[model samples]
Target: MRGFRRGLHRRSLYHRSLHLPPSPDAAHAQLLALHESGDANAAARFLREKTAAGSIFPGFLSSVVIDRACKSGDLRGALLILATMLHSGTPPPNQHAFASLIDALSKSTRLADAARALELMRDAGIHPDVVTFTVMIRGFCKNRMMERAWEIFQEMIKSNRCQPDCFLYGVLIDGYCKELRMDRALELLREMRVERRIQPDVVIYNSIVDGLCRSNRFLEAWKFLDETMVLQGCSPTVVTYTSLIRGACKAKKMKLAVRIWNAMLERKIQPTIVSYSVIIDGLSKAGRVYDAYRVVREMETLGCELNVVIYTTLIDGLCKSGFLDDAYALYRIMKRSGAFPNQRTYATLIDTFCRNDRTETALGLFDHIRDYCPLDVAMYTAVVSGLCRERRLDDARALFREMRLAGVSADTHAYNVLLHGAFRSERPEEAFRILEELGDDPGCVANLLTYNTVIAGCCLESGMVLFYEMRQRGIAPDFATYSALIDRLLGSGEIGRAFDLCEEMLASGLSPPSGVLGRVVARLCWSRRGDLAAKVIEMAMAVDDTASFSLPWDDEDGAAQDEDSQGEELGSIKDGATQEEPVP
Candidate 1:
């Protein structure tokens, strides 16, 4: 038995040598070693040389090297290796080499190469197997080339050489689901069971259920869970229930999540760590932070040890809901419970405290993270923004300067946040300076939102001058600029000037916002330009009546009215106006 085992091992090593042949058997051994060590290029070179000497490299070794390269996301390298192997007088092309290449190319996102590989396989007189077709299907799915994938699938069925397996069915069905083509997903599901006579396994059912849930077809998903799984005596596993819970949470069906949770508990379906994390995340996202905490406590009571993810989720949820104090408390508790915070946890805390204008606290937290978890730009930005929000512009500016000294260039969002803080803190000049700095940097130009923000800030105190400066600097004004101008003019009771600007905006080929126009109308009415106000109202009506006046003043009354009555009148006016506009 020992001699047989040694012989088997020798055969295994020699089989690997055919794909990567060196000068001598010893060199071949070295080449095989490299291939075994995951060096696809060396293997390809060696195989090519071996084939040139009229030696046919073993099909399995070629497959192994190709597979390793493909799985490692080096499809291009794998292709080059295959080409080398082909040049070497290796055995004529076969299904395994071609099929493996196709799968590799597809996984590498080289869709065109994948298709070519498939064609090459067919040309070499090797019909692709189910694995080949399935691989191509997955590639098409990834590229959103669903039509092409389906075409290949049909061909696979037509050949009838290899039956479609559950894995193949799962890929196609899931692909349809991903595209939100629930109808097609369902059709595939039914066909697989009825026409194809293949039993849908847990993966198949999970794919369908998940697809349905993701599409927000909860009722249908539940029906599948109830009828298909339970009625068919196919017990649903943790993945199915977890997906359902997560989906229900995303759909904001808290009640349904509770029901699923209870059912899982009763069935003794031991929830994985991921299941607990999903539920905790769901609860937190729903703003039921307290309920989320309750879940954590329950896990502890049930002796289900919580992971760091659960603590982070709880802290993040508390912080998002303006419960910074509570988040801090949770952080303390998390430490006491012996789960050390990760970088993400520290980032969340720093960001939360900073956003809530707790710059000191945020800074302290950042300092702690800097000592433990590595701090990133987000951490600094949060603290900077917080400082700015608290009117501590000096501290914010100092932080920015420090970030620069540390070789950290500001991202667009970080710069915009700082600019806003400066603008709000009565430092529009500083805000303008920041914009000038940003304009000099080409990397910050894609997001027009940042431009809008800075421009809007310029509209604050004598901000019109800055707007003119922006125009002179060749920066095009977006709808946001017009919106800001309209808002500023309306607030200052400069109705006539605001209307003139609106006209200019229209002349510039800008799309008019009904909301802004409606505000203009209200301002005109306040200025007692009843005729123009009525005209503006008509224009507003032309665009959207649903946004018509919600106030009692019309083009006359300037004083405040009862909130309830005014709200009702506004609703009535809007509803009446909506009924009049054509759908086009």
Candidate 2:
């Protein structure tokens, strides 16, 4: 027996000396190592060169290569590998290999390519299984293409290749809930329970509960939790409670939010960092910062380390509540606790200081953090807007140029800020130059706010021209746009044109600003168009029955005068006016 064993070992060594290929597991490990080191292309090249030299790579190894390429976001490269596998046919690829490619393509929003990959899979004599169809359906749902997702779901069932599992039903239900199609979601739940006889899991219950809460049907959510979830032996998780808490906070029912929080604790469902963050943010926004702080303290006491998000939430609450000193102190604490402030934390501090007229401090903080965190558009816009508010247009313009040089493109909001600042500083020429620059930039499409700001700065004719230009650009005028134009026309004593604009504004389902309407009525009464003024008031009241108009007109006696006579005259005009001279 010993001699036989010795002979077998000697034969194995001799076979190794012939330079025989390594095992498939060893080859796969080499490819995975290459992928881990971020040299997936090198692995692919090695596989190709070896295969070209008559070396055979097993199907599983080939699948690993494809998976690596897809994970690296090189879907095209992965598909090429799949094509090579198809033609080479050393060992045929399996369902998992194509599934990897399909999943990656779906995640990248390349749904068309993903569908083609499925066709390729079929052409390669491989039918898609449950996992493949599930991935495709999820991709469609993520892209908000619900109809396509349903088609894929139906295809999976119609093919009878695999039955719809619990996970598949959960994905479709979640999708419907997210789209606010609660009716369809519940229908699926009913089918799962009655026809399929699949007991709804915790995940399915969570989706339904979250959907109901988001739709502000809190009572229904609670009823489902009590009747369906609890009765069906499905226990509520932290996510369910957190969803309820979020809904309560959004609806400004903090007392109910606290009750939900307590219920979660009573059930021994430990709050996650996300749950804690949501409650903290809600409390802060509700002006209950002290309560938020108490929760933070409780978290620390429970040995749950607070993250940067929690600290930032608290700091924002402090800043907005006019406790800048406290906010900065918290910032120091955050840094000391080994939690660095993110861009939002820095932006809040800088904006608060600037609002308090401490431009130098805000600038200093901005400069200190410029190299630490990547400065985003919001931070730059905040400082630019702050400088503009301080009437330091030159400094603001310099920073704007610096922002451009830094490759942070200025959006419409940034331009609007500078334009408004110029107008406020009585720099019409500079404002017009900004407008021209906006028109010249191909990347900067003017939005409604942009036109509104310019109209607010320009005179009546220029503003009217800009309005027409806005329409030509396919940008519909919003309420603010009409408000600015109507205010400008009424201020220039163009009552007829102002009334025409107001009528258009009403037709667009937007009410003019009450202040602007009051001004128009006062101007009409002052110009002895009392009949037109009364008609304007009537139209305003028609649009909103509870609308109130304050007339600031006075007689020569220096006392406020009643406009009852104006209403009487308005009635007479309405009775005798020609069709050409309409109420507007």
Candidate 3:
């Protein structure tokens, strides 16, 4: 430690007897002046050079060194300076100095260093005050070290040096509740009330109820909010109600959420925008658009300013609940009411319209909103998807160009949508070109779905090239990739290649369509290659033991029996594969 070496240096300087000030008062006064001058290093050096070692130095002066070391961005240096003074039997360092050091170390996430500082504080004969203990406890809790925080709390009580206050209790309780350990949180709350006569406040009550509700203990949470906290004269705040309403909505109990909302009103407690947002989202998701409408109207009645989220959420609900016309009307109302709509607001309206096969309406809405809010990829992607669904490829392409010309880059999903449209419309070459252009555009990150589209859109040759590139890029092929390529190979009479793909598909933990492998097995058996037939059939049979999973296209039951019976069935199958009824 620098402090240890510095201590040795100070001891050596003690015997040197350098020229000095006439009195310790003059020396101390000079030291204080240098300390306040903000050149802490010079002060420390002056202290080491002039001050007599093994003498009773003032603790406050040493503490000034500690503070300057901490402020100078040298934490270990600060701790070392404190250690050197304590070891030298200097006057006890001030509690405020220790508290400051602890706060710095704890906040920097240097918990171990902070703990060492605590031990040094004790060695200096200074018991930690409430502020010091609270800082340590808060640090441990903030780092999610609940166990250590509990240990610190127990240590505080055991020391009898400081008592835990409401703020301290709140910190630990909040930590436990956030970790979803409601049991520990409640136990502490009960102790604070019964053992210490500390009345739990609304913030504390809100935490427990929020924790319990999020834990899906809806009955327990509601009982606590309505009975336990209320009877104790601890009123629920808007934050408290918002939690319960959100919890109720998550539990799909829309009626209970509404009840909480109404209960808040009856108490003359004003609900905030967040409170309205939670219930509105819940009611709209439950297909009760009109109920959500009532809440929105209530906001208007109370002169509460409507934001885009409230409007978008309500409009989405209206669209989802089959009140599309109402959704459009609300959009109109939102605009006329002077609340500027964001891209999300327009996207909701346009997306819902497109999803409902109202592409023309969606396009109209898109054009209308363009002059107001800037266009985004989601807005264009939605309409592109809708147009592609309607097989309006030319219009979709035109919009795609317009999107880039407007300085908005198309995302991966947007490119995937356009490629899929092209493939569906039998424009394979166009799809390939689009995929090539997608690769050239660094902004796009093609996922597994993107590759699957390319594979399904191409011939075997181009598909094989992409499949290799896909593997080199570390994208694993899925059933769709194998299905498309294997179908193409099979149709072109590439039996060997098709069989290898089937084996690969099976090895990849995906079942090749039973008919594809079964056809190969039948053909091999027809050719009297019983070994290959048995090998293929064995893999199929391992995957399909139940009758429901049997090869219903032909008689595949005989292969499910023992070896001898299987051979007999195969021989029969071979015989049935005559010229009139050739093997599929």
Candidate 4:
């Protein structure tokens, strides 16, 4: 029967049923061509018109069209075709047809629609098989709707329509693991193993192991792999070791990661490119660029083809470690090796160049990649920040406009960068303009950083006004906000106001920056407000005994000598010396 069906599919069933006189073979060929050419719309339109015109499509042909639509990411169109097939009743929709549609819809996050399609399949007297239910379960788990997924699993078991399998258990376990619900995931794993007698596969073990690592339960992960996995006869794959390496890197346990890498090699499991990439990235981020390069060389020696991602990781690591020339040299090597640098590679190099006072070089790189690569906000932010750091406000402004013109809207970070630069460059007017621009756009709500940046730029009076305005907008002042205001007040000689701000800072349970506090105390003492300075120091120490106060008067005996000097200064003010001479 299968051979007969294949023969029928091979031969054109009909040639001239509709206005168009093309055979089914010719129509199918045209549809496939359209799909391959990336014109899914034309393909869908052609299918819909043929179906609407009473053209009889073979069951195989309908399934082909449906599969193509789903593969093209046209879930809506695929569902429509399925609906048309069911309505026509010429070629009844099979499990494969419904499964394709259900899988696509579920993956697309239209879970409810996928459920509806499942009901339609059942109503048409086609019972959904295990694959159908698995797809739905995976979709729900992926969407983080664990409750719904559990209900589906329960229904599958209770209804006896299809026995729950290891794959189903694996899906739910992975979902729980991803949500950091390791306990539930383990519970399910136990139930699958002991109760259902389903041996957990490597995939399930990998999921739980990865979950343990990600949740920082590395000890348990290690124990499970060493003891439980060995007893259960499940061998750890490269993915399992890679997960361990990644988790170790995240926890900054590079020594442990290296040990795991060695163990993987001892087991004779060849490391995949991803495993190499993980180690390289981890080492590079840990300031071990030379070690990362050695791994790259080792990978090449083992005859592993170097890809763009590995090169990009090394480039970024070198850039971060302040080896711009080395990073650029590798980049040139990568290009010569026929591996193109991606946006991240370009962004990393550009950011590094800008940081090292090489804005022009950064700009040149940006211009070179602008036409080829779609510039993301991070790339634009890097250039704008670098230009701002260079105090090239005009050039920064031009680039900001260019970013918008490129259809990439500036995020809050981008705006914050510009606002901070404007304030740092003493362009108060430009900072205010940015605030106004943020206000005009509903999407760009001013965050605390925006307010803090403006306050950091303003004088005492202007800053105070902005602070009150920030409060009126119900934006609470954070540590940065309070610090900025207090620092400005102290610099402007508003000693009393600075103290009041300190009181607010204490009330909010935020300790002022130690350096700023020290400077304020020194300034007060220099201005002959020695009594007030002592009081402020005592207040800060009372609030936080760990607070270190730097006094203008230094003594060799440290605490004892400083205390004696403070007492003498306080007594001098109390003894009718209403004013003391300012320190020259």
The estimated TM-scores of all candidates read 0.58, 0.67, 0.44, 0.65
- RMSD per candidate (Å) reads 12.1, 14.5, 19.3, 14.7
lDDT of 1 by residue, 1-584 (tens): 99669758866877676666454565456556778777777676676566666666556556666776666766666777667665664554456667777877777688888898888777656788888888888999977778998998998889888889889999888889889898898899889889988888888788878888888876677778877777767778888998898887876666456557666665567778898898889878877777777777767866788779998998899888888788889889888989998877887987887776666877876776676766667777878878888888888989888987887777888788888888789888888788777778665642556656765776555557656766777777776888897788878777788888776665565667668877887777777888987765555445444433343222233333222211111111112222211100
Candidate 1 lDDT score relative to the true structure: 0.73
Better of 1 and 2 by lDDT: 2
Better of 2 and 4 by lDDT: 4
Candidates arranged by TM-score, highest first:
2, 4, 1, 3
Best by lDDT: 4
What's the CA error at residue 570 for candidate 2, in Å? 57
lDDT of 2 by residue, 109-191 (tens): 99999988888888878899999988989999888788999999998889888888889899999999899888899999999
Off by over 4 Å in 1: 1-45, 48-56, 68-77, 92-116, 139-163, 227-233, 285-291, 297-305, 321-347, 359-584
Which has the better lDDT: candidate 1, or candidate 3? 3
Best by TM-score: 2
Backbone clashes (count) for model 3: 0
Question: What would the per-residue lDDT of candidate 3 be over residues 99-131, giving only the tens digit for each residue?
Answer: 879888998999988888888888777899988
Clashing pairs in 1: 51-89, 550-570
- Give one digit per residue, the lDDT tens place, for model 4 in 1-584: 99778656564433232235566556666655665567766777777777777776667666766777888888778877777777776576677878888899998899999989888988888888888999988999999999999998888788788888889889999999999999999999999889989999999999999999999987678788877886788888999999988987886667556657766665667789999999889889988887788788887876889999999999999888988898999999999999898878888888999999998999899999888889998899899999999888888889999889988888888899999889878899988898788788665888888888888887778888989998999998987888888788877778888877877776666666677778777887888978867876776776675444443222222433122211221111112131222110
